[model samples]
Target: MERRRSSSCKMSLCKSASSSLGYVDSSMDVDCGSGWKYAPQVVLVKIYSFLNDTDRAIMARVCRNWSLAFEAGCLWRRRRFEMGGYRARTAEFQASGFAEKFGQHLRYLTISCNHPSLVTCKIFQRAMEAFLPKLQRRAKLKEFRFSRLEMDRYWRYEQLKEKLILTLTRFLRQQFCLRVLDLSYSQFYLSAGLRIIESVGLSCGHCLRRLIMEDIFHSRLTVYSGLRYKRAISRFTNLRTISLNYGYLSDDVMEILRGNLAGKLKTMRVRVYRSDPHGHRITKLAWNGLRRACPSLKVKFNFESIGFASDIIPILVAGIPLYELYIWTGFDDNSDWRLSSILNHVAVNFKDTLEICNFEFDNSTEMIDDALFRLTQSCVRLRSFITNAVLLISTIQNICELVEQRKLDPRTFHITACNLSDLEWAELAYLQEKYANMADERSIDFRLSSDLIVESRHAEF
Candidate 1:
């Protein structure tokens, strides 16, 4: 009777084991399906935010629910439209409901008409008209960037230019909450440019922080018109950064900015490309005015013409606490002594505030070892030091030693020259390897490149 009971228990144990295996097999065979389709809407939206335009389109086609969620999420907050000559189909536009969606959610909008297909003036005008009502409802809009790429050719068409100006003026008048307005590379009549400036000054003056008006031109306007527009720009009291590039900065404009912006302006970038020497002078009065008005202004002045350094450098060294200094000498007119003196003066005077120092000399005749060493030693806050001058290996060693001793954290240290030898490159590589191995908690980057190519990394030539 006991033997029979033991055999019966063994049989029952085998049956239980087989039933457990069968249960596991059946559970594995059950298809769970796509888990993403069942995810919460917020989780789906967060995932969709990482996708690019093409990827988002592909994801939308994955299923119906994903398409709806993608259309309603934060992924559509920033929209870029490439305006070619062709108009979007009416049915497609209506179905997409672009205006309704964008008006409710768009914070940034970029409209580009610089394609090869060449959108006609009338088509662009009609498109702007169709989108205007939607744009008017963008209460949360903060940035508006309009590019009429290669305006030199596009502006030749009178109808296109006029329509663009009208549309832009209308757009500007309504953007009361805009913080950034970039009209770079877009040609507009002097009147239209002034009107846009006036609209921003009156409507969004309290909120506007950055205004870029690069490559703006007025067909036959004189310096008087620029002076008038300067007064309009002055009304933008909260502007922190302003860039007037490519044929915009005249003496009168600079003077007006000095008197108007005063302590409010933080950065001013002026780039002029005229071959005539007279057009590039930012006179002593203007320089002195800027120095007095905005004592802590960061100035980036780039000109193809020479001879303004003598007038500008002393003022920069004297009063203004420059944060960034970029001097691109287009001509080989400055002496090595003059360049060294400028660097030394900056290292001594602006040491507390200077963060970026970029110098592109016409040639590599100057050896800036001493000036650079002094700068690295003095400027504890210097984050980026870039130069096109040839540097000695010993100088680089000194800089590294100073930085290590002071525990300085510089983001970028780059030297561009044609004279860096193989020995110097090897030394840089050794230093980089040593720094990488060191357990020191500091970020130090050393880069050496030739004049023909600009590359970075552990002694990557």
Candidate 2:
């Protein structure tokens, strides 16, 4: 009995010793630092660094490995919320607490919607409330462009009027570091006319630098009232550049703009619509306004009506110091306006700053040819002569000759006729041959329709 007891005691002692040894080894392994595992925080950062905002947000929800990826603030840098509808598989919605996840990194935000309804506005407001606070807190957003898309062009005229007030209030009131605000293509009608003018004119006081009003063709009430100018022009102390379509400011409206914006105007672009009998007055006003408002303003007036250019050219030459000139047939049946004398006058007055001299006409190729011949003979510093379909083959040849001889200061001549096909190839070939014969120093870009096929054949002189 005594021997058996001693043997059992020895076995017990050995088991205890082995257990102690294992514990000590385990402690040593942990302290050695080589056995440290990667935590969720580190892994999330690595994932964010590799992917874009939308992708990163998606992957973060996949599993435990990705949850932390979204929590890291840098993943939400640029937030683009295109209103209306985006396909589900392509665009991600903020339904899954996305705003709370990465709102801090939004530096640039663009909000686009097509004639948003009341319900749509509410939903947008909710989303904005969710994300914008975080963005404002985290990033100093520098640029914001809100585009209100009009599908039918005329369908949303009434809807825009009702909603524009609320929309502008929300946008301007929101504390953002916005430098450039572009509100284009929002159809203006009588219902929303004065409100829009008031909202933009009043809200953009100290914040705006550049303003562009395009294609504002709406109700006659707003167009005739022209009351919007009261607020619109008053807030332009810091404005350096302005571009307006023909519909917004016709020739007849120049009488109203004299004391309003004349002193501050710097660079102006007037797109004249010729159909209105008031067009002549508008053209005259533009010339007179530029001369009076800005002593040395650079004007780039696009003549949309050929009939009016005859009257407008003289006014422009006498009134303002035009830096560039681009003339084209307005959106109607082609009407040829003799441009020789006008071209000569431009070349004579603004000799130093003449950059782009372009003419776009539709038909009567012979008339355009005569215009080109006269321009080539008289104007010495012509840069770019862009002729639409109305230009003839002979005109192209003459312009090419001047370009090849180095007599014309321009580097390119874009000759476009009706359509691009083999139909106009004969004329193109003839012009190419003439250009080659002249040993042209400057290469010309030739377009039979719209496709550019060859450089000037006379590019060696």
Candidate 3:
């Protein structure tokens, strides 16, 4: 009996020692009773690193050490929260003091309010009022995205919009170190939008690199309102990329952008709908002025009408070097010749510098072929080419030859017109295999649409 009792006591001691080291006792089915406490704080953090925000919150309740580690701000670097669905969790987050503790470590924050009935403007305003104060303590935030998702119609209350804009402006004023600010697709009153732009320029102009204020125009505002907005946008002197959509791209807008963002802006995308007759047409003078201001700018034009293309394309070809060009436009049957001419011009002008070219047009089938072929012949430095134009088999062969000679990866080239014949496909396969062997790289992927093949004799250039 004495021997048995002594042996049992020895086993108990062994179990206790193992438990202290975070080892589970298989026989007793027990844990270390918070053995993470005994480990290094960093090791504890590493263990919790795999857990997401909600999981970490649950883990915080396990013990005080875990709570401290959870609140240490390491795991809260990137946080995305939806306003409506997570009200309970958000309340708990605030109650637990996690907002104040974790806000200091936040680098990327995206808050979205989508469900209209569930998340009203008042609710969002109140939430921001409470949350932004805590986040203001963060010395530097990399990206701040606030989006309100609604389809078909916009929030109608001007008062609510003003309140939301005020909250956002306050938040922006605090984030002096922000780099990317995307307020795209958010409805704001024209005056409020201008104020926000001005505020961002005043506060974050130094570090702000990418600013997207697309689709902020209100229908009630006049074309003159866009001019005012442009003046405000001009204040962002250090912006690298700026995108504006659904607003008039008038002469004034271009002149303001040129005067303010000269030598600083790199990429500019402007999109306007054709339904608005009040939309200001971009003039050649305005285009040339902008080109002279920023000599190397990649431009994207998404226009509903092709009437401006005749003027726009010539100016682009004549003015600054285009690094990348994306045009999505509709054309009448008569416009085929014009489209072809514009494309050939682009090919010749931007051959050396062009890296990405995407052209999507309605109608004009065979007109694009010759121009596309010319483009391929001249633009040997092309990295990504996507077009809806049908390429001749001979053209495909030339492209493949270029890919081989230039040692360009075939995967970067995409053509969305016409499947190749078995013979042509086999030849393409041979070229890909040969290139793969020569370069010692992965197999090349040449994307060809299977739907629109046409029979044409092979012609040599």
Candidate 4:
């Protein structure tokens, strides 16, 4: 009896040691606790990482131990809460303990309020007033993005909009090390936008790398508003990349940017919406000065029109290192604009720097053969030249020379906008056949859009 009792105590000790070491089966709970229940903190956090915030919450409900793992800061680094649906998810993200609990761990927070109902907008506005302040004390977000998909319809909500803007501005004022802030695809009142810009320049100047406020507008509210923006942006000590709408980018603003951003600025993405009617106001002198200051600067300028407004002037500037130029056509189009002059200007101005030029004009637009020839001849760095503008077989021959002279990489040169006649079709076929005969590695592969290929071609297309 004494020997049996001693063996039983020995077995109990062994069982306790196994349980403490977390070696029990993880598949199901046994007489002893499961291995997962005793899993290491780091191991449990790794498992929680695989689950999103919603999934992690569900996992936490399984047991108290999993809930502890869910609270791990590393698992809550990036979070996104929506107001309204994702495009219009639910009506709004309700106020909850989630922000208060994991606010300290948030590194990147994106809050999108796109197409919200009146009721949801009110709820979200109030919730944000209480919510974003909590983050300022503890969460030093690396990037914070807030965007709305609503159009000019929300301009009527003046009182509510002002409150929300104030809330966001207050949040920005307290930010310390924010890196990127994107407020594109949205509209803010003139005063509200200026306040936010001022806050960013004054508060986030130390560590901000990129500031994008594209399509954010209502700038024509006051003339002195330009000076306000200039003062605000000049204070941004370390801003690298900035994006602005046509209304925001003016000669005065660019001049200020030329002095302040100079060598520090890298990219400026500008968009011109036709509906805005206000043309891009940056002149050649200002752009050239900026170029001189920042030799490594690149500009990605896009022209977008909704076709409802009148045709806008060709907004491309000469002597600027325009890396990419896209002129997109919107819905119903009949523009009284000419492309020949613009092409000539581009051929001469952007010869050394032009890389991708997508001139997507409507079918009514015409292009001169000399303009095409000069563009292909001068801009040797031009890699992707996709346009809906008409072209002939002679221009096609000029494009082939880009690959033949080894001036361009044959594998990368993508050319569309081919409109040819029956005779020209035979010639193009001959050219394609000739290139096809070359070695597989050294062959000319011109990637063209199928939609732009039309059978009816003229000798003088």
* lDDT of every model, 2 decimals: 0.62, 0.51, 0.61, 0.65
The lDDT of model 2 is: 0.51
lDDT tens string, model 3, 1-461?
64333223222222333233332222343233656545566876887799754455445444545545654567667767666444634432342243455567788877776665434555666666667766776536889887663311445665666666777787788888888887766656656767877888888887799987666554434544455666666667787888776354567777877887888888987655544333345566777788788876777655445434455464453444466666656555455436777777777677776676777655444445677767777776667777655455566556666676764443466555444575665554455444455344544445544333444432210
Number of the top lDDT candidate = 4
Better of 1 and 4 by lDDT: 4
Collision pairs in model 2: 251-281, 251-282, 252-282, 262-293, 304-330, 404-440, 440-458
Q: Quick one: best TM-score, which candidate?
A: 4
Write one digit per residue (lDDT tens) for candidate 4, span 172-286.
8888879999888656766677788888878877679898888665534332236677787778767789887766767787777788777888988877766564544557888
Candidate 1 lDDT tens digits, 1-461: 64333223222222333233322121133333578656677877887788764455445444555655666637767877655445333322421345554466778877766552344544555676667556776546799887664455454676666776676677777788888888775656667677777877888877898888765544333433355676786677777888876345556776767766788788887654434223344455666687678876787655433424463454453444467767766665444435666677777777887788777765456666787778777778888877776677777667666656664557777766546665666665566555553323555466655554324553253
Candidate numbers sorted by lDDT from highest down: 4, 1, 3, 2
What's the distance in Å from true for residue 45, model 3? 2.9
- Comparing 1 with 4 on TM-score, the higher-scoring candidate is 4
Q: In model 4, which runs have C-alpha deviations exceeding 4 angstroms?
A: 1-36, 61-65, 86-91, 117-120, 149-151, 219-225, 277-281, 306-315, 329-334, 368-370, 390-401, 410-446, 452-461
Is 2 or 4 the stronger prediction by TM-score? 4
Q: Which is the better candidate, 3 or 4, if ranked by lDDT?
A: 4
Which parts of model 1 are misplaced by more than 4 Å?
A: 1-39, 53-68, 71-73, 82-97, 113-134, 137-140, 148-150, 187-189, 218-227, 245-308, 311-317, 331-338, 377-380, 407-409, 421-441, 452-461
User: What local lDDT does model 3 show for residue 343?
Assistant: 75
Give candidate 4's TM-score: 0.77
List runs of model 2 lying over 4 Å from the truth.
1-107, 112-141, 151-161, 175-177, 190-194, 200-204, 216-228, 247-266, 273-296, 303-317, 327-354, 376-382, 418-424, 430-461
